[model samples]
Target chain A: MNSAHSDIDRVPMQLVQGCLVASVQVELSPEVLHVFQQDLLEAVRRTRARATVLDLSGVSILDSRDFRSIERTLEMASLLGAQPLLVGIRPGIAASLSELGAQCAGFAAFSTLERALEHLDSAG
Target chain B: MIELGTMQIRDEEAPVQIRVKVLGLLVSLGADEVLATRVATAASELSHRYQLLGAESRCRCVLHNEYSSLLVEFRFTSAHPHPETTDLEGIAGVMRMGRNGTGTDELVVQIKLPMPRDGLSKRAIARGRERILQRSRRELMDELRAKNAELEAYNETLEETVAERTRELTHANEQMARDLSAGSEYVQGLIPDPIEEPVRVDWRYIPSSSLGGDTIGYHWIDDDHLALYLIDVTGHGLDSALLAVTVMNVLRAGSLAGVDMVDPDRVLFALNNSFQAHHHGMKFFTIWYGVYQPSTRELVWSGGGHHPSILISPGTEAPAMLEATGPLIGAVEDMDFPAERCTVAPGSRMAIFSDGVFEIIRDNDLVWTWEGLVEFVDTLRGAKVPLADALLQEAERIKGDASFDDDVSIIEAVFP
Candidate 1:
């Protein structure tokens, strides 16, 4: 029998200067996305991270369902008292999302990781 | 206990007398108002039909209270023997037709009424039965008149509600049409006029909806280079059109700080950095940007998630499709778009278009592919018909319709 935990690809996250920096490098299936949300929220609780930055530079295709997941993640972070920021969205992905009326309402978006970090640092 | 009553119908007034007796029995049985009215109505109809046969008609009604239920059985007989049971409308009871043992035809109707939850005393039942029997015909007629007025008022209210909802829906539809028309006009105004310079340029645009997202424009960056671009934003309608117009305005203004407008790769890179998908309502677009150097007769181009521009040079039998240099723009960060160079000789022509031009459904229910577009263009290479008009005609022929499912935009540049 295959083990229940055989193929779980956890999203890579790090703690930097009292903040949680989670980088999503792989295409997130629905199941994996749900697991990621649970794990990220648990990590935030454990580290008591002051801020959260989701680096989505690698995501090329984003549909309405994916945007909904991202919205839920941002909402979760805010509920946990962590300021969430998004960085590194490609132009083509932006066009597709904008066409669907997906607005970055709760989170701030930056073109580069460095810029996003700089903004977070200065704001803090 | 069971009680039986018999009536012989000899004239028109006999049916009414029987109907009053049925109502009295129902009230004594403690049946609800609606059930009592329905049972009485059924009894009247059966007796009336028997009287119309013009024969000796007799109706036998038996009322019994058993196992907390009121059971009323109506047995109707006529001398004609062929008693038609046609007046059973709106009766919520069981009925049976059978011949009696006395060589006579009979129609039997059985109505069962469950005892009310609040059981009535024997005295109350007797009093109710007495009250119904005491009411005159005038009072009964007045009660029927009141019920008709109530039903008419209810029907009027229902009709008025339907009319108000239809008016609201029509108004909303008209408002939407006006908004769409205004949006289409604004998008049309954003398209640049044809430029007659070292390079001749003309284009065509058609939106499946009132607003389109396909935008094409070309302008001279300097004396050395002419910058040309075609962009197709995802989806259609007002949001897509607005994003396409925003990108066009930025490119026209040359407002990206420290970016070289004449360089194809730099232009795409700057656009990607500015319109990151997450920042601009999570929207992304495909762009093909190229710069033509008249001095060198070289066309240097770069594309981000966009189909390559088609180049047709002198003495070449087929058009060359310049492949994409990098990934689609606005999705990833710090992406590099490499430029590809091709020299254009005199009398050569080049075309840049959105994917909608080739991905159309033809009359045969097949998609018009890039190869099909190339073959169509080949036929109109040297013809007197303009390139934009020729492509539009081909699209119409393939679609067999005037409208498309997506926004179609095509730009044609002819080198003199």
Candidate 2:
């Protein structure tokens, strides 16, 4: 009985002084991809914030399919006129993004949610 | 190349007769003037007498490519017959080739008039060749269009056949679904509902599919004696359901036949015998039969290829498992499933369940151990809620809120 539970990423999303801060969890499986799509879309529609920080520190095995599904979520956010900032990508995931070629073309990335927030604050 | 019949003009006799024979042969063989001019002038001079009409007509003749023929431009045309015309009678007329591109097409004609030679015109020859070529092209186009239409009709028929097959397949699938629903209902009917007395017995059976081979039954063999049995078929669905029905039928029939045959061992033996006699070398079943005599406070039970039954003390916090000591039913000749009798104290409760209850997993672990089950029984030993409620809760937990991989059955009985 090997009882090793998957250590999934968890995002602690909150509104700090009217800035929306989102923490992301593990890359969801294909079976639950639709759930994240709907949730992200709904959040973007409800909050007309100027910037959103997407946290992804806990994601372990993000692949091309995950990238596409996440891209759809980001597209939905953009449709609501919100600026999405990527944050907390692991070093391994970043290398994989380059290897997959064209799947991540022209996508923005960042290291931490705090840094993404600072960058947005400076631009604002 | 076209071969013409030989002409019969005699040698060195009539030069005019030889000339007409040479001209006719060239025309029949479709030779150009350049080729016809190759014929010997001696032959042409001898054949020259045929072109002379009643009046002299000036004719210029030239032999060009071969020694066998000549080209003659004659300036004579008349309705009057010629002196050498009888010699041309032995030669047959021209044989025109069919327009199948299978014959030589070397013919060319140009007639000139120094006299009244207006009968054979150049425009008439050109029109005749144009008509033949036009008819051949039109026939080819019509054949191609007919073949294309035939192909389209075949494709339409193929599409229609595919649609018809799809409809038939969908109909069969719908019928199969209906049969399964009916089978589930029929199997559910075999198990009795909660007993409507002070003694509460709750049983749950969750089939892996709409129809599975698990059966649980409750019956009163006689006054103060209640029999509870649970049987699981070795396989799933229809085969198991059929076997369960057969076992139920045989037991009912044996009981109805005589009182002596109503014993649990006797009923099971009869079922095993029937299986051996009729369904020999085939299927088998696991059954736990227990007869509870309220008057004697005795639970007379027998096990055959079934999981152990859990017995919980009425007013205590402990439970025990009664393991089977007999072979599975329908295994060999004269196989007898031995019976075990235990004294039941008043207010003592017991639960009989299948392996399905113990096989469930939760959070990647078996839901409960036998020790855990004993502790669980102790928790609900004297609760205000009925034993049926507690058992249903336990079953639901074992099923992980209705998620199970196999059939589940649990029968709880509290002795009076």
Interface RMSD of each: 33.4, 46.9
Best by TM-score: 1
Query: How does residue A48 of candidate 1 score in lDDT?
Result: 91
TM-score of chain A of 2: 0.78
Question: What is the per-residue lDDT of model 1 for residues B103-124, given as tens digits with 9 covering 90 to 100?
Answer: 6767887888776656545665
| CAPRI category for model 2 | incorrect
- List runs of model 1 lying over 4 Å from the truth: A1-124, B1-156, B362-366
